[model samples]
Target: MESPTEKRPARRKDAEENRARIVAAARAVYASAGFDAPFDAIARHAGVGRATLYRNFPDRYALGAAIVEDDLCELEALAHEHGDRPDAFMKLLSAIVERHTETHALVPALLRGPGEHALQALVPRVTRLLTVPLQRARAAGLVRDDLTLADVIDVLAMLSAVLADDGSGRARDRRMARALELLIHGLVPRAPVGSPIGPNSPRM
Candidate 1:
């Protein structure tokens, strides 16, 4: 037999482990079946009893929140890793596209109806992570000066919408690349078109 304090610590550790297991199982199930995954199925997969699952996450919303938090952490990591690259705009754009594609269900859920304040709050961190490279691209005349951080957010949202419409990941990626290329070219200042010059040398 253990002392009371020792027993409490051990019980707490076990509860923590159980909670982590449940969260992991929920993540796998949710990724495969989206938010439609059954709680019983998650409990079964986690190898925990339904009571244990509920003890860890009382409802589907709690599970969804945990998954969203995990996804955001991953995004933050990616942002920090590639936020300073020479082609940071492209990197950030690609990251955003991949994230939106991977978390298709979650994105739509967060965007639907009200209670998007949490998601909205994350935009500034995203903007700061992206704006640095975007500004650099603008300074190099590689991107449009008229574009704002909000434009980047709009483009990301559009990309998510496109992915939702066309579930073909490969096709969507190719289209996104082409679209970025066009945007980049359009940003270049155009030279005035002089009078059409014929193949012949300048007429005397």
Candidate 2:
């Protein structure tokens, strides 16, 4: 009989490959069709059987979480590596915004589903990734000191609307790029004025 230890490696390899395949297919399908894309469709797209997809990701949220976790990991690594650069925050934010454009609408909805716990756990990690570079940018005077992590997240959430699957990809990209530039500009510290005319402050 073959040794169990020898059998284990092959099994593990196949499992890892299947997981990668599922994630890739899920990314593409979710990008075009949103998170409501059928699980069976994703399994077929990955060229894996339904049982394999289930074995890897038990539900839609599980599948979505996998894609998100992978993206966050990459973003965190990029932020850590470029934390000291003056433009690091902008660079990282730009990359994240661009990537999110692909699946912006779907992510929020997926996280609100029954299996959201998996994604909820990842929120803090994504926050951590953004924090270091944001703080660094503030210290370097590239971003306003008043800016907070929540503000950054809120901006990203709002920007997601710009990338809604309307018109052509080129049109969407052009609009999104311009919107991102405007958002980045907002982060720059401005000379304070005595008047309280800012957004919600009311005119008096």
List model 2 lDDT by residue over 76-179, tens digit each.
88887885787788888888987787667657777578657877888788877778788888898878899999999889877876765455467778888899
Candidate 1 lDDT by residue in tens digits, 73-123: 776787678656656676667666665566666757655634266567666
Q: Which portions of model 2 miss their true places by more than 4 Å? A: 164-168, 191-204
Off by over 4 Å in 1: 1-24, 113-115, 167-204
* Full-model lDDT for every candidate: 0.69, 0.81
- Each candidate structure's TM-score, on Cα atoms with residue i matched to residue i, is 0.66, 0.84
Candidate 2 lDDT for residue 31? 69
Residue 190 of candidate 1: its Cα lDDT?
43
Native-referenced Cα lDDT, model 2: 0.81
